[model samples]
Target: MGPLQIKELLQQTPDGQSVTLKGWVRTKRESKNAIFIALNDGSTIHNIQAVAAPGQFSAELLLTVTTGSCLKITGQLVESQGSGQAVEVKIDDIFVYGTADVDSYPLQPKRHSLEFLREIAHLRPRTNTFSAILRIRHALAFAVHKYYNDRGFFYLHTPIITASDAEGAGEMFRVTTLDLDKLPRTDEGAINFKEDFFGREANLTVSGQLEGELGAMALSKIYTFGPTFRAENSNTTRHLAEFWMIEPEMAFFELEDNMDLAEDFIKTVITYALENCKDDLAFLENRLADEDKNKPQNERSIPLLEKLNFVVENAFERLTYTEAIDILLKSKPHKEKKFQYPVGWGIDLSSEHERYLVEKHFKKPVILTNYPREIKSFYMKLDDDGKTVRAMDVLFPGIGEIIGGSQREDNYEKLLERVHEVGIDPETIWWYLETRKFGTAPHSGFGLGFERLVLFVTGMGNIRDVIPFPRYPKSAEF
Candidate 1:
């Protein structure tokens, strides 16, 4: 009955003492005289089983209560004689504050497909999958704060809406409030952005790295964990229109130091999630393990726990872009899947290339570094070799490039040249350039796609499952 964690409830110290608990109903069943209900309040992955006895709880009363109903229980804590669990609660009283209607309720007792559950996104959190996931989410978030804050990093909140293209990827979602009627026009027939919000073109941020870089210049070390939006028309399992990214920026740091921070932070989060949410991970692991034993070799019998343990215990495989190219050349003749782009020295590694490198060759998480200069963003520091940039991507087996980062160009002249090389207007980045003009120092950062990492760690097949009410193409539904 106490507002205690479900895992802790199993070893209750006050076995016969009265307690109070508030949780939503997971499942409810009834005999002729008594009622049994499973309740979870998100303190833990395991749900508490409550036994409402005859005279105290009317079975007919419980039958009226539908799924997703919020209830409070005052009861005696006792171990269950039921086959499934070693614990149960003997309910003394039940106060149903808000009961769900059976006819209008979206979540039924029957199994619902994820696609269907996504439609009713508002109510899906009451389901077991989401409830456990969000609990893990909270713990991981706390872990992030702990990891950074302990290292003297200030939490910086970057702007959601911005006037600059950080990535220069042309994947920005436009932010405009201009009048359609009597719209401003250019010298040509095309509509111009002369009259718009901020008096020019603007967009939702794709990553907080750029702004976080500005904060790092002033604050020494800072990290931004916030929502980012992209308008790229990607409908794959790994893409989301809106997602959360954690970008950490540091001053006076080189590429090696940046990689170390990234590796440590990622491992810390994995350890935190594994230590804190064992029951949830176990449930998901068992679900995936039992799923389709008759499926193909690549599909079936995946050892998620072993791979994750290896990641936690061992070092991540690190390879330069040039070395990766060598591996790709040797693999080309044997590979059945054709790559979209030619695999060569200067070409960008396609998403498929990333998947193959991490999943096939490394068989672990890989840190691929020093990418071709032309393939990366303008801000990445150009290597001494002149042909490659100080860029890196942390690619996992199932999740390709969960983190993309680089050591930024710190020299004013070179930075300006790269700015011109990328064809972005120099006038727009005047403030960013001024930061280098005044006491410049080498700096680096990475943007980690929060949902993608969660997908890999949770063993959730789709990116949408890890994110609550996932926003993708035509998916702004509640």
Candidate 2:
């Protein structure tokens, strides 16, 4: 049989069963009579301790058993005398698969700052904190698929590179094969995109919502979970140049249906994590608590588990953008001039404003809908007042807007007009517009930034920490 995983072995009732295990050494402690090695195989947050009697292994072999070293061991499982763990491995034989240089290994057996870990992200997964985060990330991703699949939503793979900008923000990475040194130009002296690879300007997709809508139109229910790129230059705790998006588009769904789906979806996923990732979440909860001890009480976050449970158990507060703005205008922070940005009806809500609405006022997740038309995307269905659109943003505590969606404008004339008003050439997105021309049905969808969800669920303070390899401004290392 293959070597038993540490997670599996830890749960077994130790009846002197001989077992083979393989994993990396996390730490080594030497006593006068025996040596103890903490072994982990990335299966779980907890490590299994392997005890070795001195002289059972050669001194040279013992010297090779350092932190971060990979090993295979044949051992007999027995009840542990330790306080923390239930069982321990009594090492009968040990083999070093690879040795990490004691002098060069960066991850020593100690607490590491998140910033320092990011520098060595290629190897950070070996650390307990990152390993736990990655495990939770995996569980959440699996939950996302299971949740959608069980609901009869088809998984749709949208193009990573396309000619259309889904968000129309113009912040996209260009995909080009044209040689800059010998570039062809139009008579107007602009670089000729016709001479490029696709015979037109192509960019990494900023979202899959537009393509996902086409799938929804045919399939009735569709979801796209894939990498998305944005060229925004912000270096905040919440931004990433390249990230994953979870966009679900449903046909015959109105703004109310969209809101209902978003709420149920968020709650369901969080509940899954709470049930399946208890150990990892507990580790992260303690980690956050320890970190928060240094900050002011008001600045510290609610305990991670409590925050998550509160979200799962409570119903999200729903209000219109106008109502949310009114609450903010009457809030103590706004009256006392504590808000950094101005709060008004036509302005887009910033992270601070969003957090205040969720963390301070509502004390639960909030879904703010019917945003002013000018502040929202052009595809949103316009309200009768012509001043607002059927847009929704789901705001969470600690993290601001976790999900943003809208009921799409189904009328061909209004959509085309909005397209022109936004200065987008109709010819560029003729295919998307053609959907409305042929057989447009009322549809609603939302885009959930995958890293942001991971960030929230993992209780990670920075967006970069949750994603394996984070891409951001001026940094793409490993």
Candidate 3:
């Protein structure tokens, strides 16, 4: 009838039936009597081989067959005589939809570096590495929705443009319509945001948590999956200026219940990827293994498949932030004077400290809770001692803190006090504070950086590579 995707064709029991295939030509090899072409339609990572006899097409038509050329072919589906694939198409007719210039094309048949591929972000999807990565990314996203849906969690869509900073770090991208060349100023000489769009200062949301609490208060359990922006000037491999976050907020769930859900959620998605994305994960596993072999013996990593299985099978270590701090203070890194930021109480844990806990000491994922109130956000539930809040951070082996969440403060006065303590005006987020005043509950939630999870699952070192188009400081090209 019409065209069959290469993914579907590769799985069929070849019976020499006629079929139509449409895709880009990945590679072509010429012989005196025949020309063999590998066709890919982005339906799957595997390519289908097509054979053309001497008289099947003109010499001029044959010359157009090159990498990246789009083609439509009618052929006979027969069992392949080749080694890697199961089926091949014996072409009866061929048509070139478009042809890529071989003299100027960036993606050659040879293996290219990830850095080089990133420069050509628009075309990187056609490569085997990115193709497999994107497939796995899709699988992971599906698993996220399936896991939450199966657990009775309602998916909530919060506002992308918010008036208040949920994180309270003050690192936010302002969304304004005011002209910079000609500004409207107050009599006090400050630029008046009242003249701007929305009649008040607004920003691209750093999180959807504050609004998610309103949903959780009534719905009992709710989650958010959307894009978030940060104004941090970080250029690290683990950071992105714009990224996707999955935030799950639940009513009546404490820090312990939050940890249970987080652990289960992570394990479920990893297991789903392991079972469903076999071909893609295998390719990534092999890629990581090859890359690791080039590193020093001490810096080399375990196989990706084994690492995934390890996370699926093991129970995450749960401990208090104080306990983790104690372990770090007595750790060898501290004694040997190795850590760049020295370990002590009341100080925030650096990436080095987090990696030490998960990678070197525990050798499993860790859930650290009850962080000092000064180190955490203002919305976190205050402990009885008033010194710490019910904040939890889940740290993985390679990447440090993959999740950061807390039990939200249900008491309006305590939340207001904390807000004022953090130097944020209470009038700005009166809507969020109203939720606590009306129907308060012991609500808890966490923000999981989706790209970080993908990075961990795919064994990718750079955060930019996992996302389709990463936005970072000074780099938003394509």
Candidate 4:
């Protein structure tokens, strides 16, 4: 049989059962009479202590064992005499699979700055900080699927390459196979996209929501979780050129229905992480606490576990955009003229404004709805007043807008008018527009940035750090 995972092995009672473990050496120390090695298999944040009498194993074999080296250890599990762990492995035999030179290996037993870790992202997963984040990431992803499946939501795989821009932002990465040095042009002296691979100007999709809506129309409920691209050259802790998005669309659902689903969905996933990833969360919580020790008390964040519990236990505060605007206008920062951006009725709310509502004023998750039509996407259902749309943005503490969605404009005429008003060729997304023409229903959906959720749950500051390999403007290295 294969070797037992450290996670399972740790749970077994110390009944002198023979076992074999294969993992990387985290640390190794040798005394005159005994040698102790802390080994981890990336199965858990905790490591198993393997003890051996001096010269039990060949000196040459033990010499090759170092931090980052892979090994196969045959041992008997027994009660530990040491602290921090319940059981220890008494080594009976050892085999070295591979060795990492102590002098050259980057991941020595040391505290690494997150910035420095980003530079070597390929190896960061082995570190405690990243390992914990990755494990929680997995848990959250699984919970997302489980939540949707339990609710009868069909999983939809949307196209990655398309001719339409869902967000109308026009910042997209073009996908083509034409040679750049010798380009093809039309009689109009423009680049002939007809000769390109897709025979049209196609780009990596910025969102799967538009296509996801089509599925929801037929399936009644659908969700899309996939990679999305943006060409924005943003270098902030919050932005990434490429990221994953979770968008769920539902037919016969209005703005209120959308809000309810989004709130329940987010809370469910957070609860899953808190329950399933206790050890990782504890480690991250301690790590964050240590990091916050140097900060001023007022600026320091609440404990990670408490912050997560706060979100899970409390109901989100819901308010209209106009009400939120009034609150922001009366806020201390706005009244004192400390806000960088002007707070007005029709202006797009910035991250600072959103955070102030969630983190300061509301002190919980806040759902701001009915944004001004001019500041929102054209697809949102226009309200009776013709000033605002049925748009909703769920803002969370630390991270401002975690989910953005709206009730779709089901009226074909209104949708067509809005499509034209936004300067988009109706023919480009004629397939999507056709849904409103033939079998229209009041439908709504929202997109949750997966990395943003990871950032919040993992309590990591940089958006790039949560993603396995972040794709940004200037870098795409593994």
What are the runs in model 3 whose C-alpha is more than 4 Å off? Answer: none
Off by over 4 Å in 1: 1-8, 32-34, 55-60, 186-195, 292-294, 332-342
Write one digit per residue (lDDT tens) for candidate 4, span 1-478: 5678999999999999998989999999998979999999999999999999987888888889999999899989999988889999999988889999999899999999988998999999999999999999999999999999999999999999989999999999999999999899999999999999989999999999999999999999999999999999899898999999999999999999999999999999999999999999999999999999999999898799998998998899999999999999999999999999999999999999999998889899999999999989989999999999999999988888999999999999999999999999999989999999887999999999999999999999999999989988789988
Candidate 2 stretches with Cα past 4 Å from truth are: none
Residue 138's lDDT in candidate 2 = 92
Please give the range of 10 consecutive residues that has the lowest summed lDDT in model 2: 1-10
- Model 4: colliding residue pairs: none
Model 3 per-residue lDDT tens digits across residues 348-405: 9999999999888999889999999999999999999999999999998877899999
| Ranking 1 against 4 by lDDT, winner | 4
Candidate 4 has an lDDT of 0.94
Model 2 clashing residue pairs (backbone): none
Model-by-model lDDT, in order? 0.83, 0.94, 0.92, 0.94
In terms of lDDT, which candidate is strongest?
4
Mind giving the per-residue lDDT tens digits that candidate 1 earns over 350-455? 7778878877787777899999998999999999989999998888766678889999999999999999999999898798888889999999999888887788
Report how far residue 59 has shifted in candidate 4, in Å. Answer: 2.0
Runs with alpha carbons beyond 4 Å of true place in candidate 4: none
